[model samples]
Target chain A: MQRTPFYQKHLDAGAKMVDFAGWEMPIHYGSQLQEHKQVRSDAGMFDVSHMVVLDLQGAEAKPYLLKLLANNVDKLKESGKALYSCMLNEQGGVIDDLIVYYLSDTAYRIVVNAGTREKDLAWMRQQLQGFDATLTERSDLAMLAVQGPNARAKVFSLMPADEIAIAELLKPFYGAQIGSWFIARTGYTGEDGFEMMFPAEQAEKVWDALVGAGIPPIGLGARDTLRLEAGMNLYGTDMDETTSALTSGLGWTIAWEPANRDFIGRQALEAEKAVGVQQKFVGLVLEGKGVLRSHMKVTCEAGEGEITSGTFSPSLGLAIALARVPVACGEQCSIEIRGKLYPAKVVKPVFVRQGQSVLS
Target chain B: MSNVPANLKYADSHEWILDQGDGTVTIGITDHAQALLGDLVFVELPEVGAQLTAGDECGVVESVKAASDIYAPVSGEVIEINHALEDSPELVNSDPYAAGWIFKLKLDSTAELTGLLTANAYSELVAAEA
Candidate 1:
C-alpha cells in the first residue's frame, strides 16, 4: 500500500484508517458527520495527494489533448487554466475523467483518480505514441484540498503575503505556482478553496500550519458525503469504463460542436444523440425514512435501477443519492432497504453547491 | 478511555448485552461500534416477536460512513426494540449502552450468554485487532 506524505498527520489525528484505491487512507478523524458539517460551515482540509498527477510535455500537447479529451481545449486558452473533461473510449464510454491544466503551449498537467492511474497513463501513452509527448508522473508532489465557505480566507491568511497575492490573482479554473507549491481555485467539495500541491516533504509542515490556523483535518468519510452532497461523481462507484458519460449525468461536459474534429467516442455520442439515450442519471432525496446505499435497488414503473452512490447528506439533513434509471421513470421512486421499500424524490443532480442548497 | 462504561457484557462483534437478571437481556451496539461507524444515520431492526438464533442477522445499523449488520448474540425472540431509533438514530452514538439498546430478548437458554465475551475481554479483542 502506498502512503502519502500526510500519512503521519492522519495517524496523529487519531483518524480511522481504511483502504482506498490501494492506499491506506484516513476515513475520519472522529465523527464523519461533524467533519462534513465542519467543511460546510467552517474550514476543512483533505489530503488528496494519492490521486496521480501526470505532466504531459511535448510539441503536440494541444492537438493531442484536443483529440483525447471530450471538452473543448479552447476552454483553457490562458496558460495555467484548468478544465475538467472525460477521456473516452471510441464507444462514448468514459475511460477516465480527469482535470487538465494548460501549463504551457507544449506542456499540460493532468490529474486522474488513483485507481485508474495505470490505465489512464497507458491509454495516454498509447495515444501520444505517434505524437512526441513525454509523460512524467509527479509522485513527489502532495496535494491538499482546503474547502468550505471559510476555506479560502483561512488558507489565504496563512500563506505568505507574496504567495497570497499571487494566489488571489488566480481565478477559478486557473493555477499559479509560488516556489514549488501550486495553488488552484478548484475543489470537489462545493466551496471556495484551493487545491494546493507542493513537494511531498513539505506536506507535513503545511498540514500542521493549516491545523494551527484552525482548519479541521477532514478524512475520506466526510469527503465522500461532502462530494455526494455537492452532486459530484466518484470514480468506480458512481461511474466506470462500462458506463457512458451521457448516462452518467455528464452530457454538458461533452463538446460536439465543430463537426469535423473526430474525437474518441464522438461517433457513439452522435449516435446516442440522434437515437436518444435510454437511461438518465438523477439525484434522489430520501423523503421517507432510511439511509440510501450504493447498489440498493431504486424502483419505479419505468424499471428498477440501482443507486450508483448514496449516503446521508449532512448538508441536506437527509439521505441523497445518484441513480441511473430508465428515462421513462417517474420523479418518485422507492429504494429497497432490508425488505421494505422507502419512497424518494428525484431532483436535479446538485442538491448543494458553493455551500448553498440548490434545491431550496 | 472507558467511555465504554461497565456493568455490561459485550460481544466481539460489538453488540453489548446487558443482563436484566430477571431472564431477558437488553442488547445494543457498543460505544466502540458507534465510534467506528461515525455518524449513526439509519437502523433496521427485526420486528417484535421474531425469533433469532445466536449470531443471526436481526437488524441493520447504518452510519453515514457505511451500513453494517447487527447480529444477535443471544438466541431468543425480540420482546421489545428501541422505537426511538426509528427517527433519532444518533442515540446509538450518544448513548450506545443505555438509550441505544437495540432489542431485548427472551433468552431460550442462559448458557448462551456465557459464550459472550465480557466488556474487558471485548476491549482486549478490539485491541488485538487494532
Candidate 2:
C-alpha cells in the first residue's frame, strides 16, 4: 500500500488504518463517533495527500478547461481564485467533481479524488490535443485540510505573518500562494478552513506544527460525517460517472448566465432541463429507532429512492441520510432497515453550516 | 468492552449466552458488539418465544455506520427480550455488559454452546481481525 507523509503521524496517534483507493489512510482514531463529534464541535486536520494534484500550463489552458468542464472557467481571472466544477462525460453524467484554481494566466491547479486520479488525468490529456496545455501531475505535493470555525485562526498562527495577511482577506473559493505552498480557503467538510498544499518533503514539519497548535488529527470517518452534515456529496457514493450534476444537488456550480458559452455537458444538461428529470436528491431523518445506512431503500408516497450516503448524524443527534429518489417525494417516508420499513421525514440537506443547525 | 461477566458464555460473533441453568440459556450481544456498532440507534430483536437453530440470525443491531445481525449461538426458544432497546437503544452502548444484554433463550440443545468460542477467544478474534 502507498503511504502519505503523515502515515507515521496517524500511526502514532493510534489511528485505525485502512486501505483506501490504494493509499493507506487513517479510517478513524480510537472511536469514530468521538472523532466525528470533535470535528463538528471543535477543530480537526486531514491528510488528504492521496488526492491527485494536476497543474495545467500553457497559453491555451483557459480555453481547454472551458471545453472540458461542465462549469465555466471564465469567472476565474484573478490569481488564487478557485472554481468548483464537475468534469462530466459527454452524456452529462459526472466523471468527477473537482476544484480548479487559477494560479496564473497560463497556469491552473486542479485537485481530484484519489480513486479517479488516473482516469481524470487520462481524460484531461486526451482533450488537450488542440490546446498547447502541459499537464504536470504534482505527485510530490501533500495536502492538509485544517477545518472548522477555529481552523483559520489556528492555521494562521502557524503561518508566516506575510502570508497570513493575504490569507486573512481570502474570500471563500479563493486561494493565495506563499512561495511553493498554496493555501486555498476551501474544504470538503463545509467548514471555514484552508486546504493547504506544500512540498511532500516539508509536510511532516507542517503537520507537527499543526499538531502542536492543538488541531486533532482527523481521519476519513469524521471526514464523511462532516461532509454529510454540511450537505455536501461524496464523489462516488453521492454521484459518480452514472449520475448528472443537475440531479445531484450540484446545479449551483452550473454557469448558465453566459448562455452563449457552450461547455462539454451543456447540450445534454439542456436536454435534461427540457425533458425534466426523474430523480432528485434530498435529505432524510429517521423517525423510528433505526440508523440510516447507504443503499437502504427509501419509500415515499410518490415513489422509492435509494440512499447514497447515510449515517447517524452527530450534529442532529439522529439518523440522517442523503437519498436520490423520484422527484416530488414529500415530507413523510420510510427507510427499509433490516427487511422492515421504518418511518422518516424528508427535508432539504444543509443540516448544519457554520457550526449551527440550518434546520431547527 | 462488555464485562463478559464470568457467568456468561460468548460466541466469536460477539453474542453472549447466559446459562439460565435449567436446560435453558439466555442470549444477547456482548458489550464489545455494542461498542463496535456505536450509538445504538436501532435494535431488531427477534420475537419472543420464537424458535431458533444454532447460528441462525435472531436479530440485528444498527448503528450510525452500518447494521450487523445478532446470531443465535445455541438452538433454543427465545423466551424473553429487552423491549427497552426499541425506545432507547443507547443502553447497548452505555451498559452493554449488563443492562444492554439482548435476549433470553431456553436451550433446545445444549450441544450448540460447545461450538462457541470463549470470551478470551473472542477477544483474540477481534484483535486478529483488526
Q: Pick the candidate with the highest TM-score.
A: 1
- For all candidates in order, the CA lDDT equals 0.88, 0.85
lDDT agreement of model 2 with the native = 0.85
State which candidate has the highest DockQ.
1
Per-residue error (Å), model 1, residue A106? 1.9
* TM-scores, all models, native as reference: 0.95, 0.92
In candidate 2, residue A175 scores what lDDT?
92
List DockQ for all candidates: 0.80, 0.54
TM-score computed on alpha carbons, candidate 1: 0.95
Fraction of the native A-B contacts that model 1 recovers = 0.90
Off by over 4 Å in 2: B1-7, B22-26, B30-40, B83-96, B109-111, B119-130
Question: Compared with the true structure, what per-residue lDDT tens digits does model 2 show for residues A1-360?
Answer: 999999998999988788999999998876677777666667799999999999999999988998898788888888899999999888998989999999877899999999998889888889899898899999899999999888999988887788888899999999988898889999988788889999999987988899899898988887888899889988999999889898898888888867877788888999999999888899998876557888999998888899999987777777888989888898889888778888988889778887787775
lDDT of 1 at B38: 72
Query: What is the C-alpha RMSD, rounded to one decimal, of candidate 1?
Result: 2.0
Model 1 agreement with the true structure over A208-236: per-residue lDDT tens digits: 89998999799998889888988889988
The TM-scores, chain A only, for the candidates as listed are 0.97, 0.97
